[model samples]
Structure formats: C-alpha cells, structure tokens
Target: MSGVAGDDPRDPAGETKLTFPESWQVESSDGLSASVMFISGLIMVTRNRYLAWPSLLLSINSVINQHPLRTKEGGNSPISTVILGVSALLASYLPLVMIGPQKQVPLPVPEAQ
Candidate 1:
C-alpha cells in the first residue's frame, strides 16, 4: 500500500507529535478515576443517595473525553463504542439522584454575649 494519509495507522507523516504526560499526573488521574468508579459502583449498589450522586457525576466527567465521538475523524474504536452503548443502556434504569443538601456542615455560630 502506498504511504498515503489514510493508509497508515501510525500516521508517520502527520503533524501530530508523540508526547507523554507526567508520570505522576497519569498515575494520579488513573487512580482517581478508578477509585471514583469503584466507590460509585458500591454506592449505587447500596443506593446511597448522597455519595452516589457525586460519584456518578465524577464518573461521567471522562465520558466525552474517552468517547470515540470526541476522537479525530475516521478514528474508530469498537470497544469504546460497545462500552459507551452498555453504559447508556445501564443508565436508562440506574439513576443516582440527590434531593438533599451536600453541605458538610454549617458555619460555627459566634458565641452570643
């Protein structure tokens, strides 16, 4: 096959550069994301309204970031698409809702004279 723009998976001719993130940043983000999802699953299973709400929100932050729809044109990921479809299907019945305040505590009242 000719070395054409659409022929190469590596895109050796593309202008994009191969750069890596800081190890600590990668590790921390990976850890945080996994922990959030794990805790979210636990909260969801237990139906904890308060914690589940925040966890669900946190877990969704990477949806668009990791989704194939956000990838460059012609980029295809069958696994990603399948995962997204499954998540969407599961989300239809699983709703983590919060109706109460998430505040940790009220400010300490000053002593009255």
Candidate 2:
C-alpha cells in the first residue's frame, strides 16, 4: 500500500495482497530530450530565426532517434557522424546569423578649400 517512489516494489507480509493491472511506462530521458529540443527550437525561431536552425536539427535528430531506421543498407557507417556534422555545420554558421546582413555606407568626402 506504500506508494513511495523509493519504497521496495515487494511486500513481505502475506496478510495483505496487492495486485496491479498490466501497465507500461516510457522512460523520460528520451522524451525529455526531444521535448527540450522542440521547445528550444520554438523559442529560438520566435526570438531569432537563424539561431533556431541548430535546435531544429537537434530536434530532428531526436525524432529520428525515436524511429527505427529504414533498411539497414548502410552497414558500418557512423550514422551519428552525419547528424553531428550537420549540427556542427549549422552551429558554425550561427555567428553569421548573429552578425546579420551586411550594409554598405557611403564614403565621406572632404570639402575643397
């Protein structure tokens, strides 16, 4: 009857019997990671569109990780390498986004005496 999180999952007293119906639990780590990526992506997109790219990629990876790969065609290839490379590539361009578009200024001219 004790519902404590850390309590032992078993009961030693035979006087009382408790039965739990079949149930399932999905671990939080994966879902949490994906949710975090998605939320961060949403925030970034709203605040700064360019910086959102990395978060988008990360979220995509999280999604992809959840599903089984289609056709084990590529054997011995490091799938993560591609994901990491793309993320890194996009992240590398983050500074460019921060700098934003460039503008040209007219040169100043001195008046002739």
Candidate 3:
C-alpha cells in the first residue's frame, strides 16, 4: 500500500513534476524583465506619456534581432521565426500592461453649507 498507493496516475514512477518558476516560465522572460526595467526608468524620468513609445521600440528591436540570428544559424523554420517574433512583441508589451498607469477616481464634492 505504501509504495503503490502514492504512485502518480500518469507515470506511476513518482518522478517530480517538471516546473519553472513564474518569473522564469519562458526563455523570453529575460526580455520581458528588461522591458519592465526600461519602462520603470522611463516612468521615473517622464512619468507615463513616453513610456509606451520606448517599450514599443525595444520590442520591435528584440524581435528583429532575435528572429534572423536564430533562423540563419540554428536552421529554425520560418514559422518558428514568426512565432518567436510575435511572442517577443507580446511578451514585451505584457509587462507594460501589467504596470499600466492607475485609474484616477474623482472625489465627490461636498454640499455647500
């Protein structure tokens, strides 16, 4: 009962489940982190007006730089390059969306005395 009862239904080998931390789920997490850091710096400098522009630029750069090198050297498929490019662009903007500017609530005015 001890050895057999605890066996996993799928593997029955008691192997540990494979996992990566949320912070490192994908290979592009590094790029996401960099985008977040840069966005933070931009927010510090100019608040928020110019935040999206730099993030957009960096995302484009990352996709352009990443796809060709991987495809040419690693012999990856064109579809893979397209997927990677789209993924990188999405990942870059995801962090920005998470840290987007807070919505302001207008205070209620007091009735005149």
Model 2 agreement with the true structure over 1-113: per-residue lDDT tens digits:
86775466355543356787644434333543445455454443445444455555655565566433422343222344335434544555676789988899988998899
lDDT per residue (tens digit) for residues 1-67 in model 1: 5755567666666557679863322212344345665665665466555565455555565453464
RMSD of 3: 18.7
Candidate 1 residue runs with Cα over 4 Å from true position: 1-29, 64-113
After superposition, the stretches of candidate 3 with alpha carbons farther than 4 Å from their true spots are 1-74, 103-113
- Please state the error at residue 80 of candidate 2 in Å: 22
TM-score of each: 0.32, 0.27, 0.26
Rank by lDDT (best first): 3, 2, 1
Listed per model in order, the count of residue pairs whose N, CA or C atoms clash below 3 Å is: 0, 0, 0
Best TM-score among the predictions, by candidate number:
1
- Reference-based TM-score, model 1: 0.32
Q: Note the residue pairs that clash in candidate 3.
A: none
Two-way TM-score contest, 1 vs 3, winner: 1
In terms of lDDT, the poorest run of 10 residues in model 2 is 69-78
The lDDT for every candidate, in the order shown, is: 0.50, 0.50, 0.51
